[model samples]
Target: MEKKIFENLSKICKTINYIDDESDIIKYSKDWRRRVNEKALCVVFPKNENEISKILKFCFDNELKVIPQGGNTNLVASASPSKEKEEIIINLEKMNQIHHIDTINKCVVVDSGVVVDDLNSNLEKKDFLFPLEMASTGSSQVGGVISTNAGGINVLHYGSVRNNLLALDVVLSNGEILRLGSKVGKDNTGYNLKDLFCGSEGTLGIITKATLKIYPKSQNYFTFMASFENLKNIINFYEFISQQIRFPITGFEMIPQISFDLCIKHKFMKKSFFQETKNYYALVKIQLHHLDEAIIDLLEEKLSECSNLYSEIIIAQNEKQNKEFWKFREDLTEAQKLEGKLIGFDVSIPLDKLDYFFTEGKKYIDDILKDIKFHTFGHLGDCNIHYNLIEPDNLKNNFYDYEIKIKHVVNKLIKNVTGSISAEHGIGLLKRDDFLKTKKNLEIELMRSIKRVMDPKGILNQNKIFRN
Candidate 1:
């Protein structure tokens, strides 16, 4: 935050609005989870890629650092300013625009700053959908989600942001504009350089625009909540239902009974028809291209084939109830937060070892950690679990040492199962230590080499993936 840089930024961003107020700058520096709040020199709101290119070039020339921001709703603080280095944030909110929607290819080209829900709402008019469903859809921007390769409810059907993306327009550290891939359905050209920036976590470059695949909107939908008697039964049921269903399931969330009760306690939902007392609940959703009320009866008949897996099941009577059920599952994180201190772990397990990850992981936590609730919930179809360890009421708020031990042991378990430490949430400042310690030496080195090549001066999002 030198006076020279401040004056230069003021002159350079004369066309755009750069926040000079201390309070406003501090707000831009914070993570959405309110986990980290660090100092930022200033926040520059750019209108388009040209403005961003100019800002990045100036910062690069002066050896100054800059963090690219969009929506600022990341869970892992991937878009937050640095804690160790002085950096400026280039907010992309003003660059919001839906450039094109190709009717033939069924794709939409949009700026990085377009809100996810807003884009989907626009697409819905044309009987199309972006199909990225998440709790933060209303606030999360395209650039932010694509950068983190965000996986949400539709990932089971539509895949991650990386899978849906067809092309990208990015700005590198030295102000060079690199457009990777194209608007084509598939391009088996040389290396897919676009994939490198999809989940780069803002360390290498900034995504300015993206062309993503869109699906035809499904008016016919069915949602149901089934309560399982045991942990093994839930996994068994997921495998069984996935194979039995004709259409790809849009969402298959696994929320434990405790989480469901907590959501009720916090009034995340008024009530649920699926109020059977059980250990686990599977909130399954299916989208049918053709409207058929008989499908519900058919699904019930199929459920009878595996009645041993659960105690009860309730299908939504209408669309309103169906949405309410999904809301209950989405509000789980907030409900858990209201209860006590929550430590989040987004890990992916193989479909076969998912049951083991839960049973064995709980055993380890119970043996060493002693007093904590091992709350589990996530997309069962894709095998991504949001495994959370919560400090319950009556427990003294001293779990710092316990947290260190928990991550160490849990990471080992994930490594053993050939699962990734990061499933959807990319490795940002929060998971940097675990990533460095658990990742292979060669893998880390390769990433470091790539980092060097992309931003040799290490000015872009410094001290993020690797501590420089």
Candidate 2:
């Protein structure tokens, strides 16, 4: 069966584009987390939508499971293959192309394989910006980001990929193509199908192209880091800043002391802003067409009023300094790897309940676990935090023994606060069971119905979002 499928795939794709070697299959088998060790029968790269349609039609006819992949940077094992090795990986890296940029519409039409950073670079020349920002922008492709509905530091202002996405061109399970939404902003047409595929994680269909909204590049940026004595103070200051800052604030993030320590220990950053670290730190960024004395004075006055809340503050003087401050926030995930084995949770709570969730969640973990360290940070403007646990040196080898219990305690706390277990990261293989348990029965049924309607054969990204 596998031989016949490969033979047909070869007839459609070029020789160089079809790969079945163990080395190549292994390369595209695992995700960024390196946790799953699943291999594929073969990997094929389609150059255009017509080729993708043909491949899907073949897979549908044969009832072969297919895994649609882009950039392979998913942390939740969404793009990884199954351990049974029954699936074929459809990689979209070769289909990268910027089809058109309509300045009049303030949107860019692009192929799914276009890297986020590369698109931003191209837009920079024309003074336009694709506002979907993520730490993995360098390796994350447009289709992958859209499928996952990625959110980052800029989500506070520009929103996530779902917000920036205006239209989509998707290839469904039966090889039929769907062009959803439109280039124009206003269209009260039928069901908003574009959103169904935005965060679908390749379960319902494969996103082949997209039209995304763009914004004019900011003329000036003000980046600063502020230290708070406690989490409450940090929350209070954020509310105050959100109310006072007249200009558009592009980014807002919170970093706990443990994350800073890990960065320093790993040599990710050399300079430390404070002589003594505080309980929490907030990174704020504001965008403006011009910076003047009045705006500076108003900002200082606002900070003076909140002096009791913050212990110290430092604003970037130049672009280099701005990047330096951001490096501290962006390098955290990698820095934690140098410490020990880690378990991470991407969650979101109401803005007002942010401090309560952290305070209670930390206490719950501390009560049950011994010798476990916590490194917490994320987009505070939006209420998402990457609450992570680091395994101690003595228990590094045995961390998996306590994985289920820890997740249960943490997820219980999240549910208590009415928060989502998976925020920016989609429910890939990692959180599928948790999602099934936590989500309402009707909601789950609706999702299952949609999945069945789109992929009746259950051949598109099988065993994802739900177990087969």
Candidate 3:
């Protein structure tokens, strides 16, 4: 059956490229999540919209499941296939091409496989900002970013991947090409389909290309790192500064002291941002292009008002220092990788309730496992907190063994604080159940209805988003 499907796919997508070996399938089967590995019957790389449409039609006609994958940087196991090994994997890497760059419209059409950082660099040459900055930007593809609606540091001002996206060229389940949305700002046309594909996680359709909105690059930025005696103070400072900074405040992040300590222990940074350790730290970036001396004085006055709340403040006086401060934030994921093992989480709570969430969450976890250490930090302004558990100190056991049990506890705690289980990370296979816990029955039914209507045969990414 698999051989027949592969032969059909090859005939349909002649433009597509492939290395059809079990070894190649083995290499592409798993995602970064690594929670589970499922073999793909075959892997095919589509080169263009026509190739994608033909492949989809072939799969639909053959009654075969097709899993479309981009960079595979997803923390959730969304891109991986089910255990059956009956699905054909459609990789978009070969389809990478910048379709169009319209400076007049301030939009760019890019293939789904273009890396986020590479896209940013391309746009930077023309003094435009893509505005999505993820730690995995170096490897994460544009299609995956749009599919999962990935959000990052700049979301506070620019909004999520969905906001920056203007239009999408998607290959629907029936192999029909869909051109949803337009570059024009205001389009009150019927249903907003662009948003539906933004975070669909490939259960709906394969987004072949995206027309993204670009912003005029801000010329000046004020980046600062401030250390606080308590995590609550950082939270408090966020509430304080939001009222003062009329211009866009790009980033509001909370970095725990142990995370910084781990960086030093691993020598992640030559000179730490702080000379002395504190309970929590924050990295805030304020965009200031038109502000003059008087406005700068007012900004300083506001900082001084919030200064008493924090113990130490390290302002980025030069562009070099600014880069260093951001590098510290950007490299945090890699720094955490240096730790023995991590139970990764991307949870969210009300911005006002973060202090309660942390205080109660830490207390509960500490009581359950006395030696447990947490490296909690993320976009504080957006309320998306990534609470990661480092390996317990002096433990000689396998950390991955406790994943399921820890997730239950973490999910319960997040629910208690009115938080979402999976914040920016979509419910691939890993957290699909948790996503159910956070959503209402009607919402789930609506999502299921859409899935059913679009994928009547249940062939596209089977058993994802909706549990069967």
Top of the candidates by lDDT: 2
Clashes of each: 0, 0, 0
Better of 1 and 2 by TM-score: 2
lDDT of 3 by residue, 12-127 (tens): 65322124566677777787856667787778887888988888887788787888899888888788887657777888998888877788999999999999888878888999
Q: List where candidate 1 sits over 4 angstroms from the true fold.
A: 14-20
Residue 253 C-alpha lDDT in model 1: 90
lDDT of 2: 0.87
Give the winner by TM-score.
2
Global Cα lDDT for candidate 3:
0.83
Q: Give me the runs in candidate 2 sitting further than 4 Å from their true place.
A: 14-20
lDDT of 1 by residue, 64-89 (tens): 88888888888888878766337888
**Deviation in Å, model 1, residue 452 alpha carbon:** 1.1
RMSD of 1: 1.9
In order, candidate lDDTs are: 0.85, 0.87, 0.83
Over 4 Å off in model 3, which ranges?
Answer: 12-20, 291-294
Q: Write the per-residue lDDT of candidate 2 for residues 1-468, one digit (tens) a residue.
A: 666777899888842212446777788887787778878778888999999999999999989899999999887889887655788889999989999888889999999999999999999999999997778999999999999999988998999999899999999999999999889888888889899999999999999999999998886888899998888999899889899878788899999888888888899977577877798999999987788888788888888998899999998988988988887777888899789878888999877787778788778777767678888888988989888888876764577677888889878878888999988999888888889988999999999999999999999887789987
1 versus 3: better TM-score goes to:
1
